[model samples]
Target: MSFLDATIVNVALRTLAADLRTSLDAIQWVVTAYLLAVAAVIPISGWAARRFGARRTFVAAVVLFTVASALCALAQSSGQLIAFRALQGIGGGLIMPVGQIILARAAGPARLPRVMAVVGVPVVLAPVFGPFAGGVLLDWAQWQWIFLINLPVGAAAALASLRLLSRDEPQASAPLDLPGLVSVCVSMVALTYGLGEMGRDPSATAVLALVAGVSLLGVFVAHSLRAAHPLFDIRLYRDQVFRAASLSSFLLSMGMYAGMVLMPLFFQSVHDTDDLTTAALLVPSSAGAAIATQLSGRATERFGGGRTVFYGALLGVAGGVPFVLIGANTPYPVIATAMLISGAGAGLSVMPAMTTAFRALSPDQIGHAAPQLNMVQRLGGSIATAVLVAVLQNGMDSHEPTQAGTMSAFTVTFGWVLGAAVLAAWTALVLARAQRREPPRVDAPAPAPQSRA
Candidate 1:
């Protein structure tokens, strides 16, 4: 529900602008505010869980998210909606990471592969399905239904969580790091919103925001080193396995998520299909992801994470090759095949990489690590979007809308996606080597010889 809400409202942007009697720029805040709020709140998830038990925190988050969703549905103006969306984001941001913490601690490192596969189903499927579902809803229902749909799902999740989740003891707490929280929140919100703006309109305000965000990020890092109980422990990166997993995630996410933007444009510009038709054409990719998720965990357990990721990245490259050389006249079947292969590769790689990260951390560290991974993945997607948008815009410098020109623009960006996949493969190999170096040797007993000595 949280993941779906993040992307679903995008398809409704135009409709929102029309119905609310506002410009696209104004209605965009409805989405932007939610993302910024999520970014701001992510660093606090660990603290929240440690302060309150996981079960209580999870229930509260769901209740807050569900209540905000209901409020969003009832919003009378753009301002009201954006405000409520920010409220919703505060709740939405913690749900996934907190849930990961609970499951990771319960499942233990041995079962992390299976756990991640289960956790991954909705995470992988939601973004792929969000826009399509939204398009369908808009075709047949009112705009409010998009937000309203979350109410039942969130409520059910909350109730089940209350009954089913174990009441684990909360960790010993220190005073919240107010300065660290402020610095991190500011940096995240500014950077995320600025990059998002850069994708749409590169303005002075966006540049300033980026600069401020980077500067504050430096401050936060410095402060974290000195603080006893910082929002997150930066030293986690000292673990080679965690570092490698994070790098792989960042690169693969850039490659995979670009498709969310690129494929839709490909269908609209080159094939001249309607929204519904384009969405239908993309179903194979989502299906491939679903299939891969079911099989990837066992593959990771058998072959190890490095080999699994390496193979997945190879599949990604093969899938992306078609896009690099694509022409305006390319058949839909061919494009569909490329998307399917790409999505399958993504689904296969993501779970193993995440599980690998968790395996590198202690149970106590899982809460912090989960949010950090999520934040990095979100940042990766934002960076990929900005980069691709710039690439596409540069390729279309002549302002031509011809199919050939559009195809050229997409080709350039898709080439980068291919390059990112190759890098992911290399990183996976590195991660494998690091994992090998990490295990300590178990010595055999010296038998009766020691007694004689």
Candidate 2:
């Protein structure tokens, strides 16, 4: 739900502006607000699970998100909608990480690869499908349906979480580190919003926010290393496998999401396709990712995550090759085929890296570890989108408006995407080498505990 929401509303932004009688600039904030809220709140998700217990935190998050969705659907003004989206983001942020923490503890290391693969389905598929889903909603119904659509899914999830999720004791009732929390939250919000601004408009404000964010992040890191109870454990990065997986997750997210942005734009700007048509063009990619996800777990189990991720990253790099040469007359079938390969690469790479990160850590380490991994992935996508969008925009602005010239811009953007994928592959190769030395520790099976969530 969190991931889906991240991209779904994009298709509705224009409609939202028309309906609410607001400028596109204002309506865009509806997206930015949710994104910033998600990023800002993520740093505290570990502490949330620790304080409130994972099950409670997860359920409450689902409920909050669900309620916020209803409010967004009913919102009468742009300000109200943006506020509701931000409210919704708080829930979106917590639901995934806290749920992962619960599942990680339940699965244990021996079974983590397979179990977390199940968890990773949304990570890869959401971006691919989000625009498609939004286009469907708009074609069939009003814009409100986009927000209203979350009602059933969120309700079912909350109810199921209540009944199926096992309850666990809170790790600590200690007070949240006010200093660390503020520093990280402010840093994330500033950093993400700044990144968003960089793509939308490269103003001095964006530069200032980025500088402030980076500076504060440095402060938070220094504080975390010294504080008695840091918001998240910086020490987790010391583990070589965990470190490598985290880096792989970050890089893969950058390429994968930026490509998602590029795809719709390529089809629309270059091919003059409409929303529905572009959505349809993305189907093969979605299908490939779906098929690959089913196999990723077993692949991780058989080959280890580093090998699986490295191989997957290679597939992604192969997939993007065709796009570099895309022209006005480039065949649709070829583009579709390339999308499939890249989607499969994303499916094969993303979940395994996340699972691998979790697999490297002990159960007790999950609370601190999950948020950091999640943060890096989110921030990576945000930063990459900013950078790639800037590159594509500049390339287009400088080129002639002809089809050939526009295609040139796309090719340059795709080169950057390929570079990111190659970098991810390198990181995964490092992980593969490291695992050979200190192999992923598989814990002995432990008895399941009986409890009500």
Candidate 3:
């Protein structure tokens, strides 16, 4: 339900604007507000979990999310819906990350890869199922049902969590790093909102917001350097593996989301498929990804990060070829095959990247790094979506009414996606070399607990 909510509203945005009697630009805030809230609050998840305990935090987040969903259903205006969505995001941001942290903590090093693979399946599937589900609900039921559906699932998850979750007492004397937290939150919120606004209108206000956001982020970097207990310790960047992993993650998401936003349009307009058919055709991508995740996780454990990433990137680029070459009459089987291959590549790449990032950090740092990586991935997705949409819109506007022109535009946009894939591949090569250079560590007892800073 949480994952579904992330992208489900996207396809419904136009309908929502008309129903709410709002302009397209104003209605965008509904999506932006939720994303901004999620990005802003994600940084504090580990701190909250450690301070209150994971089970307690998880349960509270579920309750909060459920309540927020109800509020969304009851919203009478765009502003109200946006506000409720933001409220929902606050809870939603914590759910997956906290669950990841718990799994990481419980699984230990030897079995961590397998656990991550299992967790990754739902993560990938969420976006795939979200749009399809939303389209179905919107076709048959009122738009409000989108939010209403979460109630039952959230309630069940909450109750299951109470039974399945282990209770741990809160940590003593953990520093909150309020200054660092405030600075980062301000920076992320400003940046996210500014970018979102720019997607609708690159006006003076939007430009100023973008500038302010960048400046705030600069301040955050400086604050982290000086603060005694920073929200995310800057020193972690010194780990070559972590740096490679995080950057690869950001770039991979950039490519993946850019393709996602573009492909649906291609399917609908170029192939003349209906919305449901387009959605259904895209399922192979997620299905392939889900299947490959487990295999990639195991491969990463045995073969190491470099080889896994290199092979995955190769597949990603190969998979992208069909989209680049797509014409007006491209076959559905070909499209589905390309999507599956792309998804397989994603599955192969992402788990290794995540595991590599987390493994490079200390257990205490895992909390911080997990959220930071999540933030980067979200930011990358947002930026990629905005840029690609702009390109597509421009292409559609300028091109003459011909099949060739339309295909040309798609080709040009996909060229950018291809560049992203190559970049990921190059980064994978660098990571491989770095991994080769690192000294091997003997399996040893786990380190003692360190308080959050």
**Best candidate per lDDT, number?**
2
lDDT of 1 by residue, 313-421 (tens): 7788888888888788778788889889988988888777877776676655665676677777766665665556555666656447788777777787788778878
lDDT of each: 0.75, 0.80, 0.73
Model 3 residue runs over 4 Å out of place are: 17-32, 76-78, 193-206, 269-273, 397-412, 439-453
Order of candidate numbers by lDDT, starting with the best: 2, 1, 3
- Candidate 2 to truth, TM: 0.88
Candidate 3 lDDT over residue span 372-439, tens digit each: 77777766666666556555555655688577777777787788788888899888877777777863
Which residue ranges in model 2 land beyond 4 Å of their true spot?
13-32, 74-82, 163-172, 195-203, 394-406, 444-453
